[model samples]
Target: MKYKKLIFSSIGISLFCLVILLFFVLRGNFFKYTDINSMISEPKTNSLIVSGTWELSSITSLSDGSEVKSSEEKLYITENFVYFEKMGTTNPKFKFRQVNFKNYLLYNGVVTDKINIDTDDVIVVSIRDERNFYKEFIVLDKNKIATIYNKKYYIFEKKSDNVDKSIIEELSLDESSINPKKDISFLIGVKSIGTKDVDYETFLIRKNGDEKPTADKVEGLFVNNKNKFFLVNANENEVFVTNDYINNTNKISLGVKNATINFLSKNYISLESYNAETNKKNYSIYKIGELSDESQMSIKDIAGDKGEKAYFNDIRKLGYSSDNINLYDMKNFGVKRNNFSWVFKGILSNYSHDNFVSSEIDLDLIPNVDIFSNKSSKISKLRVKEKVPDVLDYFVSPDESVIVILTADDISMYEIKNQEIATLPIFTTSLKNRREVVTFQWTNAISSELTYTEFMKIKRSN
Candidate 1:
């Protein structure tokens, strides 16, 4: 009996020690689960929170009861603010708010409410209206979020934070061994002409070609590839085409006096001229090789007639959109004294053969570029805390992944997917007295290889 009692006591002591150890282990895990700092760390290191950018992948609409897939709409969430970009908007809609571990408050905006959090990592946002009260539940995970609203689900995916190592080689084109153009990577280099008569000195930098192609005298320039480029010289009243080499140039006379020419694409060029006989403005599209008129449509025909006269200022092909182009028109309606003007009007239009949509723009606000998807279109406006420098030229990538904005002193590249910006190593050589002209030629062959190095640089620089 004594031996059995001693063995039982030994077993009880062992069991007591195991319970103590198990309690501490479970306590440590509980602390980790409730730790707010670990949950909201940078997205690069942590994935279990909603702290970075989430792009709209698919959304179910309650109004029409239809499902729409949208890649252009984005939502950026930080500790301080929540910025949202909807389809067809020229600027990001922002709301000032504060976030905690389990709650958030919108201090200022059209809708002010306190949101709650649940144990399942679901965010519940409630809004009350005169007609109906609504609730939205956003289910969060490491890399995806499903936002439920009005009996619809809006899915978002977290953008990848990985940096592509190939960017260093792509940007460092001068040091590469392979042919730049042949391998699908090319860089745009612009040299300013010091002379007053010429405006642009543009050339393409490729590994297989000569050090630099001859710079052309062009008022407006567009490049399809290293072998083909189009130029418009209003002073000469001609549209020049160069193929195989820049020295081999062909000219086609437009036969319009005081006409402003813009290169639309390899196949089309837009001509804006004043008709003295009719005392009105005329716009026409001409084929590149034949210089034949393709379409002769007035501004009023496309955009409804306002009381004021409109002048075509610029035109560019919308990226990712199916043959859709944007036309910009400016009119001076108010009085001007020296440098000050009372009113200036600007109009932007999305134009295609079958459809036309137009909207007015404010001159006081910075202009935004429009991005269109199959289901919806979104406008991306520059929203910077500081004043932005004067933009000399800008180019959008073929995939609509990035945009490069060139100024007199520096070049800034913005990533649309991650909502990040980086400045490239290239600089401009234009002097103060000379006209500063910078243009970009985007090629699918080269842009597809760009990596996350540029995006990572932006974060490190900040």
Candidate 2:
């Protein structure tokens, strides 16, 4: 009888302890859930917020056979229409048709123009032929009703309204001009000229008569109106253009001792320097070089010293976004800066494509981590409903409010407001590597006329 009583007493104690522990656990989770909900419920000042994970396309296999998809897709958003290009697979003989996203939706596929997409007065660049590389580069400017193509030395413009009247002329190219064509990443726009062998001298031509021989390998060329030119390059380092052009000397030094003087644009440049004492990564930047000497300052040094503890870490990727260019100091745990304890460099706009905002981060920084943002203020990571690895690509809206994350297992769109979660889309894809998810978000201007203006203009192309 005594032994039975002792066992009952011990059991009751254990139960009480277990209940207390469970209560703490539940309380912690409840607080976290509440925090996320509060973050999502905040009001947004921006009109539309869009963001997402960019991924390569996937192949869907039916009982019949397998299909392939190409990865060269871009999103073009204008005041009237949103254009999307989805690349389809080529035939066995190496021929393929670029999948017109709009045509696919028109062919009874489950795709709909968003409520905000104006379709009536809409005109878009059509990829007539996908297999032809040269024609693929041709983007028809709908506003001018013309098709623009790239020639070796000039931009050929052809009116889409009247296809016969195409203006094919050399864009301000002379005997002294040498246009260096780069076929690598088709994201940047400016065409570079001058001595290829030389390190710091390149004749950056923005528009005709807007020619300037800039002496910094890192200073890129921006041509505004006619003669107005802006050089986006590092000015402080050895790479620089003299105040006066070299009138006497015809031949300049073709090579540079500093091999890292590669000018990406007037707003950005890449410099290479080495430190002897601490073996630190040495990079120099001259932001706003065209201005007075007081204005010209070293961007790298400013970003580097922001952290209280200047631990020497390798800067993998760095560039500006919006107004400020940021450099990511990679030291295992993603970007390390003393600025905000966990903040990173802001992304920059892609100068070549007005549609894209250019930003760079080393692949090593925050690899495999999901990045989410609420358009107005908050950006965070999403809790994975399921485990999946390998994200192919990501897409964020121009406003940076909503994000669609596509993985090997599923694709989802998350709505964020301020610093919180508002909604997760009900529609989820079970396919692996589901690519080409359209990213969209809500805006304050929810008028029907503004949303559906382009819808009225859809007509048969005669």
All candidates: CA RMSD (Å): 17.2, 25.1
Report lDDT per candidate: 0.38, 0.28
For 1-462, candidate 2 gives per-residue lDDT tens digits of 999999999999999999999999998778644553321222223211111112223222222222223223232222222222211111111112222333322332322332112332222223322222111221212221211211111112222222111111121121111111111000111222243332222211111112221111122322121222222222223344322221212221212233344323333333344344533343333333333323323322323342212222223224332232223322212122121122333222244544533333322222111221112222433322232225432323222333444554544444434424445442343432222211112211111122122111211110
- Among the numbered candidates, top lDDT falls to 1
Tell me the lDDT of candidate 1: 0.38
lDDT of 1 by residue, 217-325 (tens): 2223534533344444455354444432233345665566645443244454455455566454544544456563333333433233331222232222222232332
| Candidate 1 backbone collisions, by pair | 88-377, 164-452, 184-445, 184-446
Worst 10 residues of 1 by lDDT: 332-341
Per-candidate clashes, comma-separated:
4, 42
* TM-score per model over all chains: 0.35, 0.23
